[model samples]
Target: MNQQYEEKLLNLIDRMVETASDDELFAGGYLRGHISLSAANCEMCGKTSVDAMNNAVENSLKETQSELNPADQLIVNAMWEKLRQEAYNK
Candidate 1:
């Protein structure tokens, strides 16, 4: 991710942590790792757009779906979408 989007994502996650429910908090932390790692992977592959970053994150999560229960996966996906909108949609 670009520095601006990276900072935005960090700020968004910080705010979410402050007000999120228990489930959201858990999903936030879990998704943070995926998001950051995905961004890094995208950068390494020369994919810098927000869409590329989002796709990497989603694909990573899908690859590890067995790690979370169905409901938790839903929560994580929802949070990811919300964060993506907040970060990229301005």
Candidate 2:
């Protein structure tokens, strides 16, 4: 993963710290771990595309889906999609 992509993703998460609701805050914190891990994995595997980074994050979340209840899974998934879109738009 490129440093720019990782930075953009982290920036989005950081920007949400002040105004996000409790659920959004939780989702952001949870996603931060997955996003960081995915970026590290992508870098290790020589994957540099945004799509690859997104896929890696999505796969990581899916792999751990059982850890969260359905509502939390929905919140996290929605947050991921929103962040992904915003990052691309920026």
Candidate 3:
């Protein structure tokens, strides 16, 4: 992610942190790690577009899906989708 996307993501997370439930907070935090890692990876690979950032996030989430239980996965995926929409659909 570039500066703009990073700012958007941080703003989203800030709002989430302020209003989320305990479970949601956990989910958001977990997703944040994936998003950050994906952004860093994208930067390293010279892919600065928002599309690349989105793809990196999706790939990271998909690759880790099996690590979460069904309920947890559902929460995480929901949060991820929300972030995706806010970050990319704006």
Highest lDDT scorer:
2
Q: Tens-digit lDDT track for model 2 on 1-90?
A: 356887898899999899999999999999999999999999999999999999999999999999999999999999999999999888
Instruction: Note the Cα lDDT for every prediction shown.
Output: 0.83, 0.93, 0.83
Better of 1 and 2 by lDDT: 2
Residue pairs clashing in model 2 are: none
Q: Count clashes in each candidate, considering only residues at least 3 apart in sequence or on different chains.
A: 0, 0, 0
1-90 per-residue lDDT for model 1 (tens digits)? 455676687679889777789988888899878877887888789988877877888899999999999999899888888888898877
User: What TM-score goes with each of the models?
Assistant: 0.90, 0.96, 0.87
- If the candidates were sorted by their lDDT against the true structure, best first, what order would they fall in? 2, 3, 1
Better of 2 and 3 by TM-score: 2
After superposition, candidate 3 runs with Cα above 4 Å error: none
- In terms of lDDT, model 1 sits at 0.83
